[model samples]
Target chain A: MNRTFGEKVFNVFNLLFFLVFSIILLIPILYILQQSVDVGAVKSGLSLWPSDPSTAYYKMVLGDQGIYGPLLNSIYITVVGTTLSVLINAAAAYPMSRRDYKPNKFLVYYIVIIPMLFSGGQIPTFLVLKELGLLNTLAVCFLPVLASGWNIVLIRNYYRSIPESLIEAAKIDGAGEFYIFGRIILPLSKPVIAAISLFTGVGLWNTFTPALMYNSDPTKYTFAVKLREMIVVQEDMSRQFEAMMQQMALSSASGQAMTNEGLSAAMMIISIIPIIIVYPFLQKHFASGLMVGSVKG
Target chain B: MERKLIGKKKGGRLGTTNIVLTLMVLPAVILLTIFHYLPLPGVAIAFAKYNIGGFQEWVGFENFQYIFKLNNFWRAFLNNWMYVALNYVFIFPSSIILAILFNEVRIRPYKKFVQTISTLPHFLSWAVVGGIWMLLLSPSNGYINQIIEALGGEPIYFFANNTTFPLLYTVIAIWKSVGYNSIIYLAALSGIGLELYEAAAIDGAGRWKQTLHITLPGLKPTILVMFVLSFASILNLFEPLYVLSNAMVRESSMVLDTYIFQSGIMQGRYDISTAMGLFKSTISLVLVLASNFLSKRLTEDGQSIL
Candidate 1:
């Protein structure tokens, strides 16, 4: 374990490389953070430090009750979607995990995997959704992921990891399958469940597509959908802001200068905050879960 | 495999366990059937003159012929392939290199910190990342542009530059995914036997030699598996283009998804859109089967779930 001079030099260079790489990765985020807090700061362009930092943007964006409604919608979809997907996946996975469940061999290989490989494209799915009367509902946001074939396969793989003897022991005691699953399997399967839930939750929270495709009602917009509009339709947002200001009988020109750039930057940071908050909890399960899924299924 | 009668032993031949399990599975099965399986038939709409309530006549191969006749279909197809090609050229190798560099870091805290920070962005939606990047590169206000101006260069729109856009787009994609994507490599790294390194070191093999001899060889199967799997996802390049794309770089950035959205989805030309969708889906299916075959061939324990 003695290091040569060259090895020592390489070590220094390695550390320096990581340091620079880390900072480069962080620069955009730190810049966004700076832009969010500083009033009219984004208009001036990027700076290492803000000349005048304030929570004006946050206050301005949060002031509209309309904003909180979308946040609520995002939460509703994320929570409902994650919970239902996990349940559906677990329910489907349990039978398949039981090696003797003969029907599932078909389900796992063909029904689940094949559809995942290729499907009727979005037009068909869109038509189907409309046919089912799911268009313009929050159900549109969550339905697609709720029983996704990928999740079913993933959960089935996780379920297979459970010891058969535990179920066998319960069966010998004359416990029904429901009791065994409810009491034993579900409890033992928390880690995988948590992992998939995190995946689903984050995905649902961040999705704007379902809203864009299925819903035209402004009230149905998720925070992500709203953020996308806010990000791209900069001029429209300012015009809306002006209209809102007039509607509120406030002085439009002199009250505060809310550039679309500043507003969108604030919206972006605000939208991402939830994911960042839950990420610590996500880190533990997701890493191991990812490796497990890749390694097996 | 062992049981003579699955439910016969305790719950009867067509036992309560079978019945109950079937019941438990029913809701999910029906959901998947409705959502995934139902629309599968609607893929037929690609061949038909699909009017919602209007007379629907099957046009046979007319739609396919139309797609073939269109230049945009080919353009979008080529554009998607370009992303895939660029991805393999730069993103794939760099991820491996990143994983190797990360594996070499002897310092635990700094290593963990960097990995955490790098992986953090992967959790952000493409829209959010696009927004952040848009802010970071705005001509008047972008951090990068500010630096560009500091160097006495005129402000240049990074997203608009078709020539440099692919390279920059790949970099952003890598930034979002590189750390998260390195998990398999990291896992593969940990799976390497320590004795191999010891054996190499005692044979006068330094860090570089050991990596070349032991580390890379150990990572071969995983790298191949990852390569094969990612190939199937080449057509699923909707999010980034949807989020980061603009008219400024439409020539460079437009791909199958965006093209479909513009010409098919927006225009309500469901027939052509469905045709395009079927075309893309067919390729995806082929790629999936191809990757599965490759995975099974490449690795000892490989099982192609898809």
Candidate 2:
């Protein structure tokens, strides 16, 4: 329990380094939060504190019909997409994990592993989506991402670790495969399922290119695609703010003042809020899930 | 006689269980065939003359030849490898160093606080991350530039200046990923026996000496496996580059991913673009196979990491 002078110095330095490093990491997010509230620093320079703090930016982001369409699209896509992905991955993984199943080897190697190694790349995949008439639809957001080799592999590994005797006992009791999978395996596999759903949900929520590539219609854009347009593609976010203000003037309150920086910050934070809320609860699962995926199949 | 009996029982039970399990796996197979397997054959478009409408003609190796001839293709190809090498030098070991640092922390609550804040950025999409960095690095009124001006130094245009663009991009990439990547190393580090460190300490080993002899050597196998695994998807780094790059830094930022997207999707040069994609995929597959082979040779159990 005794420490040398060098050790003591190292500890002090480490603490200060992390203290500063943590602050540096948080600055962007903190700056955004501050900008979202403070109207006074709209045009320039970092503000440590909000001068004219208001909730108007949040209201603009939340209430505007312009943002609503994309928000609904994102919510529906993430919900449905994640559910379908988790279900399909679980179903696929369960069967593939069964040692007695004849096709398990072929399914694992040929069907899953081969595709993981080689892909037709962007154009071919885009073409396939187009051929299937999935382009420009909300379904495009989730359909192509429904089954991933990595997710299946992770889930299958989890399934493989489940005691085989449990399934055997169920089979002895005249339980069908579907019943065993639905009743026993699904419940037992909650941890893996939660992990997959959390990742898939986040991926779907942050989905950009699929929405960007497939959905040309402004009405069909996901929150990510819409936000990209608002913040990145269009240099002049102030014009969008003016348009929002005009719409607000007609729809609700007319006198409220909000800046482009405030609006952009609010938009970024709103998009990230779902993740922030869910992450703390499921972080351990995410870490464990990553390790599981990294393990040899 | 026992083997025959077991085979007979298996054959008998295969009827119902196999049918239901096959049915369960059917959806995935169908979806994979449509989405993943189907695109594989679509790589053939790289060899053909194609456009938005359809395949125009069979142009054997012409597209590949054209891609090879283009200076832009070579530039992107080189830039792609440069990024990978730079990642090896800068980005790859960052998480390991961070994990080691985290292990050094004695205060549990502070450790958790720092770790949580660090990992938050990983959840954000490149689009959002890009937006945040753009604001933070903006030349006119960016906080970084403001600080530089306050220090009586000239503000450098990070994204616009080709010289600073790659460095800035690497820094941003590390910031976003270092926390998340550290999770794996941290897991590995926790598995290293505390008894070894205690023994070393009892033998009059200092903290630095213990780390060098016990900690790092314990981490070696995990490091080896991770290194090989990383090679498999080295070319899969598209999203970050796509969201971050601009016209000004095109000279530095145009890697194979952005090249393929630009030529194939944006410009509708499907044939040449598909060729570029095929080239990228082929290299990625080679890297994957090579890494798998290396991992088998390197690991104690002689197992492939991928």
Candidate 3:
């Protein structure tokens, strides 16, 4: 079809809007990267471009006695948590997807509605975790959120799309439920699994509230909690510095050594790197098919 | 006779196997039962005069009475409603628009680039976003204000001003979430049948008219589901406000989640906080059910949620 002049104008305007929006979106990320590299630039004042850039902050963040411990903690939780969650959710979803499974509808409703409608508030959940001796433990970070209703729903929806004839044929081969699930279902279910894994992985990696609520130990802090501490502590430190500067003008020392902006930017850049690495790999699953498949079912 | 005995044994084995299947799901079931279901009864603590390190003294409905009497709770409730309304009115629609615009771009590389840049903010913790926002919105030396001065306008201290804080919070929330939320809508848009658009075009419908009649309607189910879900969890907004809020905007910024967080965690007033939480949850539950009912009545397919 031939495009009209008005259509052409609209398309051009849309392109311009997208371009400007994209630039606006990227500025913060770029600013962070610049701050992370240019210590002197930040110390002097904020600069759009670093005159002399270095990897000193990167070295510090990655080295021992740095925030690397918490980074590793986040990674461990995300990996183990995503794997276990996907497995459990997939297993439960498989039987439920089968038409012949007894009490299927009720089970689906029970799993779906309970988490959505009702949740125990944080205090009692905390008390329960404490009673279970999960407090101050790394397991606490992943365990409570392991069986998500949304994930179960998503997996079940995906499983429903698989042809029933495939399962029926496997059953006719005298295969047990486990064999059909292992040999037939898991292989056919890779795309949905990948999608759910990415969703759960990002969720676990970025989760801070549970970490704060459950684990008070600094050593057990995930990357997210440490990032919060860094940002909040930096704000606190800057306020202190301001107060100190006000008092010090009446006293001897004229020079201040640290700036909060650089530290905060450094910490932000550090916290974001893991997500950046994982995000591109998972980006494909978030494209149209994943949701369409489930929604159609 | 031997074959019959073996078949009987196998039948018994299958019965035990089903029990094992049930057992396999036990860990999740047990954790959920304890952590999720157990705390429900504690919602009653909202009614009683809850005391820490003390015995079972039940002063019925006293906590609820106190909550109703408190001016701060009312203010917080109003503030929460404003925040939620702003989110729904602006941020939600903006996300759908962004998704449609994103879908219209045919250039593969440019689309990916835009998608990546836009979604980057969603990955940052609210603390980091707050920190960046603080720098950007700083009364002095803020990049945004600096640009405003360069353009010969007065610099605005957004976070410090109560009137602008809600708008600021809403914009930042949209900036962070629009990309992530749009992915779902984009997924919906992609599933739309191309033949419908072709059919519309053949009927002399323009792009705008086609979108009005076809694209928007095609996206209605997803839009409705998302809106209902967003409404259900409106009171759960905590991270952004908690991170961005300061003394300047404190009066306007206190929402249900932040209030609960402060009372329960910071002040160690567990009972009042739990009461407030129960109140919020009850409202959310009602909203979810009402929205689901509404959706079921309006749509032929019924609601996908619940």
Candidate 4:
């Protein structure tokens, strides 16, 4: 199709705007990457690119005393938590999605509206968790948010879009409710399920607030809390630079080399790596699922 | 035959098994009820003088009166409004425009690249994103200030200056969300029958004309739904502000959610925070209901979000 001069100009302008915007989104990440790789550059000053790249910082983060346990703890919680959440959410959503279910619509609406309108506040939630004997436990991280209102709605909406005739055909073949749900509904709802799994997994993987509130036990700390401690400690060290420098004249101190910029960058990269690996596979469904669930009534 | 029919009717009676459906939903129901619904009664604490022991005495309307009297609350309220308004004004439109532009991209690899880069920020937690932004907006060696200086402008401390808070907040919000938000528009755009665009092209319509006449109109329902959803989240603005804000810009940066987090959780003033939360929720609920009502009135096909 032929385009007008004005149209061509507008397209050019659009391209330019997007190019600039995309760079704005990526540059910060690149800067962080540069900092994380260069211990020498961080010590000297900030630089756009690393002058002397080394894997030493990454080695320190990975093999550092007191870091590996929290890392393992985070991985364990995220994997177990995400799997349990997906199962419960799917199980609950599948039943609600059944055409003949009498309370489906009401239940769906109830779940959706509750999160939007009300909340008991943090203290009450903390109190409830405390009373349940789940505080500081890994189960506390997963169970409270098992069946998210948003995920349920998303899965239900996806189930609604499935052809009713397909379910009817399965039912006529003497399939029981559980059999039909497991064999037919679950298989057909893969995209939505995959989408929700990614969403829930990312949320659980990055969860910090619950860990902060519930798990006071240093042993129970997730990667997020551990990362926070690392960042905070490094920040404190940065603030005490003059004092540390003065102390350096008196005596060479061990563990005084920890800098805010390097450790924070390393932690940031570590926190993001798992999600980054998982994200691309589910990228297509991520936006579409969210839009469908969020924008649709 | 009559006996068989009678037997079937007796057997088909709604049994105890039906209540299992409610039982299945009970966990979420109970959790939300305890955590979400239970907070409603505590709104009463807002009216009472709250102490470590809980509401010590009935101080009817005193908390509300005090909140209204406080300059901090007013400043925070205005700041919250400004933040939401800026988001609606800029990010909302930008997403729509980006979706349209993205749709126009016919090259397969370029489309994938754009989509991949755009959605990266959504995965990064607010804390991490805030750190990145902190560096980016740093006065000495930050990329943004460097660019400003290179362009013959003064280096601006974007974060420290209260005046730039709204703009910075809006830009970061858009950067984080625009890609994610545009996917709906992209989906809506794709759902539009190609015949309309083809027919428009046949009628000598240019790209801009075809977009105006075909694409925008096709997106009307999606746009309406997005607008309603965005309005619903107006009070839900907390994470970015919480992470990025510092004391210097606190007056302009403090939002309703952050305010509640500080006053309610940090200070242990449950009554006041509950009141603030309840107030925010009430307004959001009303707005949602009103919008849904209006949507139903205006469009026959639109589902009522309420």
* Candidate number achieving the greatest lDDT relative to the actual structure: 2
* Candidate 2 local lDDT, residue B139: 63
- Model 4 chain B weakest lDDT span, ten residues long: B3-12
Tell the DockQ for candidate 3.
0.36
TM-score of each: 0.91, 0.92, 0.90, 0.87
The CA lDDT at A110 in model 2 is: 60
Query: In the order shown, what is each candidate's alpha-carbon RMSD?
Result: 4.3, 4.6, 4.5, 4.6
DockQ of 1: 0.51
Rank order by TM-score, top first?
A: 2, 1, 3, 4
Q: Candidate 4: where are CA atoms >4 Å away? A: A42-48, A121-140, A163-174, A213-221, A232-259, A287-297, B1-26, B146-156, B297-303
**How do the residues A1-297 of candidate 3 rate in per-residue lDDT, one tens digit apiece?**
877788889889988999999988877777777666765533323346764677776666666475877888998998999899888887777756655444567666666677778876765566567668988899999887787666777777888888877866765677776877788888998888888887778778877777877788998898878877777776667667767867877432334322466666777777777778877766677654563322110
Put down candidate 1 lDDT per residue, B1-306, tens digits, no spaces: 435354456455356677888877777788878888889887887888865453379899899999899887888899888998888898888878998988989888888788888777878888788888987887645778888887999988787788888777898998888777777788899899999999889999999999999999999887887777676677877778878887778877888787776765567778878888888888887877887797787677766534
3 against 4, candidate with superior TM-score:
3
lDDT of each: 0.79, 0.82, 0.75, 0.72
Per-residue accuracy of model 4 over B65-184 as CA lDDT, tens digit each = 778887877777787778767877898898899899988877677677878898778777776777777766766556677778778889787888888888988888888878877887
Give the TM-score (0 to 1) of chain B in model 3: 0.92
Q: Tens digits of per-residue lDDT for model 4 on A215-273?
A: 88888888877776666565456548647667777543443344467667887888889
* TM-score of model 3 (first chain only): 0.89
Q: What local lDDT does model 2 show for residue B178?
A: 86
The digit string of per-residue lDDT tens for model 3 on B45-120 reads: 6766554553256767777788889888998999988987897789889988998878778889888888888876
**Model 2: lDDT to the true structure:** 0.82
Question: Best to worst by DockQ, what's the order?
Answer: 1, 2, 3, 4
DockQ-derived CAPRI band for the predicted complex in model 1: medium
Clashes of 1: 1
